[model samples]
Target: MILNGITVGIILILIGLYGMIAKKHVFKIIFGLIIISTGLVLFFVSVGYVDTGAAPIVSGDTTYVDPLPHTLMLTTIVVEVCTTTLALVLALKIYEKYKTLDISTLEDL
Candidate 1:
């Protein structure tokens, strides 16, 4: 019954999925996507966590956290930012065309 970053990330991902599926607002859906990405970042970072770990550059025998997950998460964050920006622009265009953020309303047209 331990609450860790991975657990929190999984919870966030689930919540985001629910929000995206259940909500009708385009902005809400976009926010859900952002939440999911954040969860993924958290999950990856937690996966690389090590207690009393030193920096990757070391000579002696010492525990070090894997740098790969952190590096990948950084790339993920950049991609997420780009994706979010594009999605927001598309949502803005949709609103401009339809004057509504509701997906159900947009679907009717």
Candidate 2:
């Protein structure tokens, strides 16, 4: 199950990368970045997952899943939300100024 999650994450990352590279719209690129972030979070969580593991609390004779990744992902998700909001705000400003969301048109202007 963990491996499956990892694989799905990798695939999502790749798809996001392709969108960022091949898409012509700024919104699409922003969406791609969001997708990449999601994939990374998924991969990170999966990496720290342990089969039949208990919570990372102090306990005797209990296997604990690593908490570092979960902690990092929490921070990452906060940053991602901020970043996405900023990107969307910037995109809105760009649209207001240029009246278009197309990268090619923006370049021509």
Candidate 3:
């Protein structure tokens, strides 16, 4: 059920969006960003699907899955990980600044 995967990705993306929009906590925003990145990665990886595709290696049999998108997805994931780390660092900075991770609390600072 490929459609099921799509639906799940969509749900995750929506939940992430809601968290990003509704939550006032800096930590939750970072997690929401991770969720959204995961959804996007899932969607991009799905595009390289083939019902009877083989691995990216040069096997004796042909019909290999496209390697381009998968490689790009890998790069994207690396960037996401770096972004997550940076977000965590920013959250830490926020905590140090206001003594609380809540965005609303930072308004007084």
Candidate 4:
């Protein structure tokens, strides 16, 4: 399960990298960043996973998953949302001023 999660996360990261690097539209680049953030969150969560692990509150001989990664990911998600929103707002403002979202066209203008 952990391996599967890691694989998916890596795939998402790759897709996001491609989107960011290959796409010319501002919104697409913003979406790529969002995807990368999501992939990072998934990767961290998978890294913290422990087989047969229980929450720290449980009193047993079972392994306990570290809560730090999960906590950090939660904070990351909040930050990602804020960053994405800001990026989108900036994109919108750019579009309103330039009337285009294409990076090349914007550059030429």
What local lDDT does model 1 show for residue 50? 85
Point out where model 1 deviates above 4 Å: 55-61
Please state every model's RMSD to the true fold in angstroms. 1.6, 1.8, 1.7, 1.9
Candidate 3 regions with alpha-carbon error over 4 angstroms? none
What is the per-residue lDDT of model 1 for residues 1-109, given as tens digits with 9 covering 90 to 100? 4689889989999999999899999999999999999999998888888889876777899999888898999899999999999999999899899899998989989
lDDT for model 4, please: 0.90
lDDT of 3 by residue, 17-109 (tens): 998988999989988989998887776666776668887899696798778878998898999899999999988887777789888868777
- Model 3: clashing residue pairs? none
Candidate 4: worst-modelled 10 consecutive residues by lDDT: 53-62
Cα deviation at 20, candidate 3, in Å, is 1.4
Best-to-worst ranking by lDDT: 2, 1, 4, 3
- Leading candidate by lDDT: 2
In the range 21-101, model 4's lDDT, one tens digit per residue, is 999999999989999998998989888878888875668577898788899998999999999999999999999999999
- Alpha carbon lDDT at 66, candidate 3: 71
lDDT of 2 by residue, 1-99 (tens): 455878988989999999999999999999999999999999898788898998889779988888999999999999989999999999999999989
Local distance difference test, each candidate = 0.91, 0.92, 0.83, 0.90
What lDDT is obtained when candidate 2 is compared to the true structure?
0.92
Q: How does residue 73 of candidate 2 score in lDDT?
A: 96
